[model samples]
Target: MKKLINNPNHVVEEMIDGYAKAHPQHVRVLSENSRSIVTARETADGKVGVLIGGGSGHEPAFMGYVGPGMADGVAVGNIFASPPPDPILEATKAIDKGAGVIYVYGNYAGDLMNFGMAAELAELEADIQVGKVIVTDDVASAPKEEKEKRRGIAGEFFVTKVAGAASEKGYSLEDVVRVANKANDQTRTMGVGLSPCSLPQTGKPSFELEENEMEIGLGHHGEPGIEKGDLQPADQVADRLVHDILADMPLGEGEKVAVLVNGLGSTTKMELYIVFRRVEQILNEKGIQIHRSFVGDYSTSLEMGGCSVTLIKLDDELTEFVDAPADCPMYVQR
Candidate 1:
């Protein structure tokens, strides 16, 4: 119930204001639409536009990814709520530069509906060609056979990274969409939740867990997970998450991957690194090469206490795009 704010209803507005002010060099709120945030840098002509968005609570996502070599714009929504189609269309129009625009977002019902509506409006009103890629990377959300039904989680970072890079490289809209889908397909993520987060308006915990209990495969919005049990050591938790990911998409001994150990919100960096230590050991034992590793709060749910591990099986194209230079508020790659 403890939150720092003047009014719950105004949290989203205030947040956008503060974010734009803090990172004016990287992003700015659209003059016509308050909910749309676009890159302050000049976009190249004929380069495909990368527009990403979802709910507001998952910071550094949706908004933080908009920059020089990342997403060109974002349609920001309220906390855990899909943005209306107006802002989406606004962002789409702002980013489009004749090469067309592509929408990259998590596989959530609200986002699908809102963004879909925005795409239709863009085509009908502005004659802008728009593409879409829905990230479905949470292996725990569904069986491998039903991957399309899986929910997107921390692995969204990989999808955005690849999509933005492709767009920056002047890929056509079709090609950008193709590479984005490839990234989502190759990525897998699983999370364990130790505590719950309360919404600003509700001021009540979204879910409950016993002091010594934990839930594996929990979604960012306090969705039910696959199993609940007594808390285990960091290594055990890492093993379980990695095991499920590998099972969903088996990797060969010589295959390469990009590892992202993401904190949900309140999880400490020390704990995350400890978990990563075990993850590295496990991968090394299997002779899998880790092309790169990122550990931090890439995507988060308010103040939830948990973390997710994301691995994107990489090939040459993916490696190049992932390693490309990107500068943004929440993430930067040199």
Candidate 2:
């Protein structure tokens, strides 16, 4: 594949190295491992610790949210792969403040397996308390009766962000898990992909789509999309995606929403904004006020072309937590 890197195996290490160099005051890369923690300061003596991890391709994720109002540590894996148990345990130990640590991530099988194993090992090996929240926001993963079985998508961001903020606010591990689970319950997401991405190591695109084609319900790992359709206008595409998500959530009128229009790597800002306009209009028509909005590449799938829409119906607590100030290299809030 045409990757702008020195080596596939070294990509995570080198990228984290540069990330540490670029944001030393905010965070520090472990140097010898893919795990990262908040820069030496910002730890509480008896407060809860927060950690998140998953595959690598979905950047500004798993790790990117570690900062003042987010995660204390992040264990990362290979591209589209779960971080091994060692790093996961390392992250838990590194961030454990005396109270305990909370593990938060998506519900991907690989992520669940690795993180679960790590939690068990941490307890048996080190006597740590680590609870987890698996974000499952994709309606396309399972039947309506089995929505909890679906795969997670961009909504994982809201879960991670809100949950991390809760921990930073000194919530208990169980309470943080509850907050994350509640956010996941109120959130839903849908996506469209315009083209394929080449995995740096594989030297091949993960999937293929002809020009003027579009994929619906595509997950981050280049999973098969729900359906292939002809390219449509940004507004129309937004309608299809948002409507489907809302229908699944059955979100009614008068609720407040925090909308996320995320670029899946190669998507442009103009297209995202065009789609955002439609989303805003639709929610407005439904009498759902748009209180907060994130329109950018919060999470990416290598260099794939497309975007995803995430909507979280918010309550007072969730809104305040999301609005809380945060400073990270990629996503910054004030």
Candidate 3:
């Protein structure tokens, strides 16, 4: 209940205004739609447009990824709520440059419905061709055979990065969609929750956890995880998450991967690095090469105290795209 925000209802709007003001060099709110944000940089006429979005609270996402070599536009929604179709369509229109547009977002139900509606509107009313890649990377959410039903988590960063790089490289909408799907297919994530977070509006915790208890495989929006047990050491937690991920998608000896140890919200960097140390040890023992490592709060769920580990098995094509230069407000790569 203790938060630094004013007026729970106005948090989303105030957040957008502040973010745009702070990073005006990289992004701006859409003139016609306050819920949409677009890149401040000019885009090429024939290049494919990349648009990403989701609910708010996961900062530096959706909106933070709008810039050169990243998403060209974003349709932001309220906290943990999918945006309506109008802003999505507006963002689509604003970024479309005659070639086509590609949408990248999580595989949540609300997101699918809203984005689908926006795509139809773009095609029918705006005369713009649109494609989409839904991210399904949380292994704990569904079985391998039912991955399509899984929820997207931190692995969204990898999917969005690949989509943006492909679009920036002038890939057609279909190709962009293809590579994005490939990235999602190669990615897997598993999370552990040590505590719960509260919503500004209700001022109540989403879920409760005993002081010494933890939930394994928890979702970002407080969805129930698979198991609950007494808290264990960081290495044991890392082992459990990595074990599940590797079991779902086994990596061959000498295979390369991009590792992301992401904080849910309030988890400290020191704790994350300790977890990463164990992760690195596990992967190295398995002979899986770590091509790139990103350890921080890439995706979060308010101030929830937990972390998720994401691994994207990499091939040459995926490696190339992942290494492409990108400049955005929260995420930048060279």
How high is the CA lDDT of each candidate model?
Answer: 0.93, 0.84, 0.93
Per-residue C-alpha lDDT of model 1 across residues 127-170, encoded as one tens digit per residue: 99999999999988999999999998888899989989988888
Q: Least lDDT summed over 10 consecutive residues: which range in candidate 1?
A: 60-69
List model 2 lDDT by residue over 70-188, tens digit each: 77888878888888888888877777887888887787778888889999998898899988888888876676788778888888889888887887788888888899899999988
Q: Give the per-residue lDDT digits (tens) of candidate 3, residues 1-334.
A: 6999889999999999999999999998988999999999889998899999999988767678888878999999999899999999999999999988999999999999999999999999989999988999999999899999999989999999999999888898889999999999999999999999889999888788998999999999999999999999999999999999999999988999999999999999999999999999999999999999999988899999999999999999899988888999999998
Q: Each prediction's TM-score against the native? A: 0.99, 0.96, 0.99
- Clashing residue pairs in candidate 2 are 1-203
TM-score, cand. 2: 0.96
Estimate the overall C-alpha local distance difference test score of candidate 2.
0.84
User: Where does model 2 exceed 4 Å of error?
Assistant: 31-39
Off by over 4 Å in 1: none
Give candidate 3 misplaced runs (Cα > 4 Å).
Answer: none
2 against 3, candidate with superior lDDT: 3
